[model samples]
Target: MKVDPGTLDWKDAYKLLIGSVLPRPIAFVSTVDRDGHCNLAPFSFFTGICANPMMVCFAPMIRGTDGKKKDTLSNIEATKQFVINIVGEKIAAKMNDCAIEYPPEVDEFVQTGLTKIPCEFVKPPRVKECDVHLECTLHEIVTFGDHPGAGSLVIGRVVYLHVLDELFENGKINSEKLRPIGRMAGQTYTRAVSDTFELERKKQPGK
Candidate 1:
C-alpha cells in the first residue's frame, strides 16, 4: 500500500511503522530519579549511533494517555544517567512487566522482582539479570514534537560496559549464548538466537 505518512495521523503512522518494522532490538533502559528511585522500561525505538565515541540512542515517545514524557525520560533528564540493559529470553517477561505505566515514585525493580546492581560511573542502576549492560551518561535529548505520540530522542555516551564472560567468544559476542529478545508488532517478541544467517560484506578493490 502506498501511503502518504504526512496525511496520516500520528497514531496511524506509528501503527504502520511498528507493523512493518518486523522486529526491532529492544533497549531495556533503567534510570534513577532525583530521590534515587529506580525506573525500568523497554523501548523498541533504540539503536547504536557510533563506535568512536561509543554512542547510543533511544526514543521515548510521549505517553499516549497523558501526552507527557515518560518517567524514564524524566529520570534521565534529571539524573543525566541511564543504563541500557540488554534483554534476553530469560528475562523477557520480567522486562515486559516493567513496561507498565508506573508512577514516578514506583520502583520497577521491586515491582518486577528484578535485582538492581550499582553502576560504576552512573547514578542509575543496572539489571543484574541482564547479561549485558551499557552504563551511559546523557549526551543530549532532542525532542521532535509537543503533541501526543511525539518522541524525544535521547543520545548517550557509553561510560562503562558489563558483559557476561560466557557470552563473549574470541573478540566478539556469542549471539547464541546471549539469546537476546526483540520486539515485534503489538504484544509479540522475537529471539535473536533462533534461525540465524550470516553474509560477508563485499570487498572493494585494493589500492
Candidate 2:
C-alpha cells in the first residue's frame, strides 16, 4: 500500500518510519545541563555522518506528550557537548531504563545504576559499561519543525574516542566482541552483530 506522508497523521507517519527503518543503531547519549546535572537517553535515529573530521548525528524528536524538547536535546543545546556510548547487549537493559522520560534534574546514571566516567575533552560523562564512547562537541543542530514528533538533527564532531582494548584489532573493531544492540519498532530491539554476512565491494571496470 502506498501512502502520502503529507496526508498522514504525525503519529502514523512516525509509526511507518520506525517500522520500515529496520534495525537502527542506538546512540546512548549523555549530556550535562548548565547546572551540571547529567542526563542520559537513547536515540534510535542515530548514525555516522562523515569521516574526514569524524562526525556523527542523532535526532532527538520533540516530545509528543508535551510538545517540548527532550532533556537530552536541552542539555546538548546548553552545554554544546555530549558523549555517544555504543549500546551493547550487556548494557541493553540499563540503556532501556534510560529511555524513560525523567525530569531534567534526574541523573540517569544514578537512576539506572550505570557508572559515569569523566571524559577527556567534554563535560558529559561516558557510560563505563559501554565498550565504546565517542566524545563530541556540537557541530550544528538542524531542526525540522517545532511541533510534536518533529526531529532536530544534532550533528557532532568526535573529539575523543574510548574503546575497549579487547574489541579493537588490526585497526578495526571486533563486531562479535562488541556485541552491539540496535532498536527496532516499539519495545523491540535487535542484536546488530548477530547473523551477519559479508560482501566485498565491487571494483569499477578498467580501474
Candidate 3:
C-alpha cells in the first residue's frame, strides 16, 4: 500500500518509522551534569555514522511528560562530550534502570547500581560493566523539525575505545564475546549471540 509520508500524522508516521526500522542498536549514552552527576539513557535511534574518524550519533527525543528535552541531551550539549556504552545481555537490567525519567539532578549510576569508571579521554564516566565503551566529543548538533517530538541529532566523534580484555581477539573484538543486544519496537529487545550469519561480498573481475 502506497502512503504519502508528508500527509501522515505525526503519531502514525512515527509508529511506521519505528516498526519498519527493525532492530536498531541501543546507545547507552553517559553524560555528566554540570554538578558532575552522571546521566545515562538508552536510545534506540542510535548508530555509528562514520568509521574513518570514528563517529556515532543518537537523537534523544523530547520527553512527552514535560514536552522538554531530556537531561541526557542537555548534559551532552553543555559538556560537549559523552560515553557511548555498548548494551549487552548482561547489562539489560541496569540499562533499563537508567532509562527512567529521573530528575535532572538524579545520578543514574547510583540509581542503576552500575559502576562508573573514569573515562581516559572524556569527562563522562564509562559504564564499567559494558564490554565496549567509546569516549566521544560532540561533533555537531543538527536541529531539525519543530514539534516537541522533534530533536537535535547529536553527532559525536569517538576518540578513544575501551574494550574488555576477554572480548579482544587479535586486533578485533568478537561479536560472541560482546553479546550485544539491540532494541526493537515497544519493549522488545534482541540478543545478537542468539542470531548471526556470515556473508562475503561478490568478487570483482579486476584485481
The best candidate by TM-score is: 2
- Runs of candidate 1 exceeding 4 Å displacement: 205-207
* Cα displacement (Å) at residue 16, model 1: 0.7
Per-residue lDDT for 35-110 in model 1, tens only? 9888999999999999889999999999998988999999999989999999999998888889899889999999
Best by lDDT: 2
**lDDT digits (tens) for residues 3-40 of candidate 2:** 99878889999999999997999999999999999999
Q: Taking the candidates one at a time, how many backbone clashes does each contain?
A: 0, 0, 0
Residue pairs of candidate 2 with colliding backbone atoms:
none
User: What is the alpha-carbon lDDT for the whole of candidate 2?
Assistant: 0.93
TM-score of each: 0.96, 0.98, 0.94
User: How displaced is residue 139 in candidate 1, in Å?
Assistant: 0.8
Tens-digit lDDT track of model 3 for 1-207: 789866887667778888899698989999998778888889989988879999899988877667788898889888999999999899898898888899998888899889989999899999888989999999998877646657779999999999999999999999887899988778888887797787988887887
Q: Candidate 3 local accuracy as lDDT?
A: 0.88
TM-score, structure 3 vs. true: 0.94
Off by over 4 Å in 2: none
